[model samples]
Target: MAPPRAEWLASSFACLLLYGFWGFLGKLALVRGLSSSQEAGLEKLGFFLTLPLILKPSATDPNAGPGLMERPKFALLAAYMSGVTAAAADFFYTRAMMKGDGGAVSAITASYPPVTMVLCATFMREKVTRNKLMGSFFTLLGAFFMARS
Candidate 1:
């Protein structure tokens, strides 16, 4: 039931644009004198506002998974922990953005993929190819240069 390559690519492109716009909007909000905590709280509220759309079964695929409350306890715990961690990260990220240049904050945060790569390689036994290593090195180098801006 996987989507076609075109669909995947289109969705990824949309994600890139949406995330970029989101950060830009968030920075604008911070510049408008909103407290970081208030920004984070309102952001979570925005996420909640979209829950219905996310949870509803779509026309193309009706076999949506079980309800969140109906899932296994372990699954529920994992989901809850994921939200908790994301909320904490969002709070810290907004705090950083509020105190520093948005571009620098964003550039530094964009380097997080290397951490994910390392974690996957260590915990999930994922292969780290030479290309991946080179890409990560370049990404980090770019982040370093941008963070100095």
Candidate 2:
């Protein structure tokens, strides 16, 4: 791995902290009788909050990046994919937790870097080097070992 910049390091830690809380608090909520449907409904607030930032007029902010405004077609498709997958995954995850699934089991099952590597190789013409394959293998292997315990 390359040396981390301060900004990147800070953001990474922030994400880790938030994600840690997300899993912990999400499971806790399930334990406390929060329904999966309610969890799914609450998650939509995040998407709603992002609408202004996403749909803001480029004229309003001259320094805006080439986001959805630049490509409406693909943006719509991507947004659809993101929304559907996130909603479905959140529903199933919360449902699983409600049924007594452990956080470690969820982490192991949701780890998809290896699947991503294979997909990129097949669909995106990306290189699949020996090291990359080995790395992915070891990652899943480690997760498997952790899960088996």
Candidate 3:
């Protein structure tokens, strides 16, 4: 069965708020002279601490998800790749914040879906529909305007 729309909406809102605060707080930490990227390193360490808690398996859980150790090697590898990329992205984003406006940095970087779409199209043979093309156009358009200000 599909999840309820309200649940999806709430989750999306929560994600928006969490990411917004992440950018704000990361920039603030840099502004406060947390130099040498130790602050960003702690942010990555927090992800490490949360990963186990987030992936803990439960006997009575409805999904019957696999624990970290039980997951397939491929899945584990993929997850590790994602984590490494995220850590790199966060480090660069924090570094950018040290020299750029947080809002503009986020606005420009968040418009990266177009690149993803193109890569998936070329690499994974994904279809690029008209709607997605239009959306990508508008995303870049808005990002351009945002960066100008």
Candidate 4:
């Protein structure tokens, strides 16, 4: 079953807000005394604090989930790749924000959904709808306008 449209929109918006703030917080931390490792440690601390609130208690079995030690090697590799991508994106974004026009850089980066959609279509055999094509066109237009301004 599909999620309600309003719920999907609300969740998307909330995720955007959370990541936006997270970026800002990370930048601030960098400006202050935190080294990259220290920043990562702090982020892990925050995750530990908040994860319990977000995860629902299991109805069938309480302690059935894999412990950190029990996670497989492939899962660790996947997690490492995820971290690498995140770090690279964050580094480039921060560099762009510092050197380039902030509004333009942010506008272009905010258009990532179209790129993601295209990638999904290519790799996951997802159908590209007319609406998605139109959205991609507008996203490119917005990025172009921002870059030009």
Point to the candidate with the largest TM-score: 1
**Tens-place lDDT digits, model 4, residues 56-136:** 666665565887579798878978998888767766676665456656777777788888898889988899999789999
Top model number, lDDT: 1
Per-residue CA lDDT of model 1 for 1-149, tens digit only, reads 55569956998889878878778888999999899988877888898998998776776765456766786898689788988988888888999999888888888876787888998899889999897899999999998998885
What pairs collide in candidate 1? none
Q: Where does model 3 exceed 4 Å of error?
A: 1-9, 58-63, 67-70, 122-126
Q: Order of candidates by TM-score, top first?
A: 1, 3, 2, 4
Candidate 2: tens digits of C-alpha lDDT, residues 29-124: 667777877765665676588788867565656556676667578757978998787777777777776675565656665576798899889988
- Off by more than 4 A, model 2: 1-13, 50-72
User: How would you order the candidates by lDDT, starting with the best?
Assistant: 1, 3, 4, 2
Q: Cα lDDT of model 4 overall?
A: 0.76
What local lDDT score does residue 37 receive in model 3, on the 0 to 100 scale?
86
Candidate 1 TM-score, C-alpha based: 0.82
TM-score of each: 0.82, 0.70, 0.77, 0.64
Task: TM-score for candidate 2, please give it.
Answer: 0.70
Please write out the lDDT profile of model 3 over residues 32-100, one tens digit for every residue: 888628878887778779899877676766757666688789878988998888778877887788888
Clashes of each: 0, 0, 0, 0
